[model samples]
Target: MRILAITDLHGNYSKIIPLLQKSGEIDLVLIAGDLTNFGPDEKAEKLIDMFESPVLAIPGNCDPKSLLDVLERRDINLHNSSRTIGDVTFIGLGGSNPTPFNTPFELEEDEIESNLETLINEAEKTDNVSVLLTHAPPHCTLDEVPAGNVGCRSIAKFMDRMDLIVCGHIHEARGVMEFGKSIVVNPGMGSDGYGALIDINVDETPKIDVQLIKA
Candidate 1:
């Protein structure tokens, strides 16, 4: 399966059109969060309408909780939810853990942990490859800032069971990492013309290929 992963749009919907146009063929679009810059739900709707392929998305710290309603109206909200595409199971968790900035969609660590645990359990029940989609990266992994790590420790611990994790919150920390058999990726900010293309081969020997692209 081929997937186009983007994050931290922050209201730069215009960038997406050209990006998708040049991305060749994509089976799915995975959006991490921050569709709007602390903006209205309308902005999120406008962005979602631009996509032709199936989209699975979640709200970011800058986006209002009402954005969830818009995504639901479009049948694309992946927050605290799971979806099966081909042989892959995608689980989504939006918003960031509490931040010093106290963004509009911040959540407590325990709340984040609880939500993820429930979703992970559900995904494990299926026989599909599991992918975790979140706005925040796992603690001390790809979520490090200049000061220190501000990621969810619970998330890091859970990584052992996942096949892949797509996240973006720390823009500068954009990159890929490996934990056990899982691949963790931060595709950076789509508003900044950065994204990731992931190819998963689920054959006799399963493998994952990822590439950072500029759009």
Candidate 2:
């Protein structure tokens, strides 16, 4: 199945719509986080409605619980929950650890760690190939910014066993990582039309391909 993963949109519908339009027959679309700017809005809802394929999204730091409520009312599925499409099992988390901005959707490191623990347990029970979707990159793989801080260390440890880890938040490391047997990637920011279009075939060795697409 072909999967198109995008994240850290931060309310830029122009970039996102074009990317989606440019994609050639994607089977599933994964939205990591920051679907909107400050809170829930019509743009996010409209974007969700426009997608032809099944979409799974996670709430970003800028998104409030009200966004979840809005999505639920509209029947859009948000992740922190897992869903299986074809042979892929998608797991997602939104938001980030506490930041100076004091965002409404902040989650502390420990809180995220606890959530990661639960996700790990659920992932362990699944036989399908696992793919992690998050707004923040794990402690220090490729989510580093100019400030030298990478991301959640607990997330890194938690992701150690997954087949692929796809994230945003760090715009620089918009590439892939083959850590031992695991594949880790940060799709970068959506404003520049930087993201990943991943294709996975689950038979035999489970062939997986990733491409960094620019807007």
| Clashing pairs counted in every model | 0, 2
lDDT per residue for candidate 1 within 32-131, as digits (tens), equals 9999999888988888888888999999888899899998999998999999988899999999988899799988888888999999999999878899
> lDDT for each of the candidates?
0.89, 0.76
Question: lDDT by residue for model 2 over 122-150, one digit each (tens)?
Answer: 87797778888877787777866778875
lDDT of model 1, residue 59: 93
Clashing pairs in 2: 139-151, 139-152
**lDDT of model 1, residue 4:** 92
Q: Evaluated with TM-score, which candidate comes out highest?
A: 1
Cα-lDDT of candidate 2: 0.76
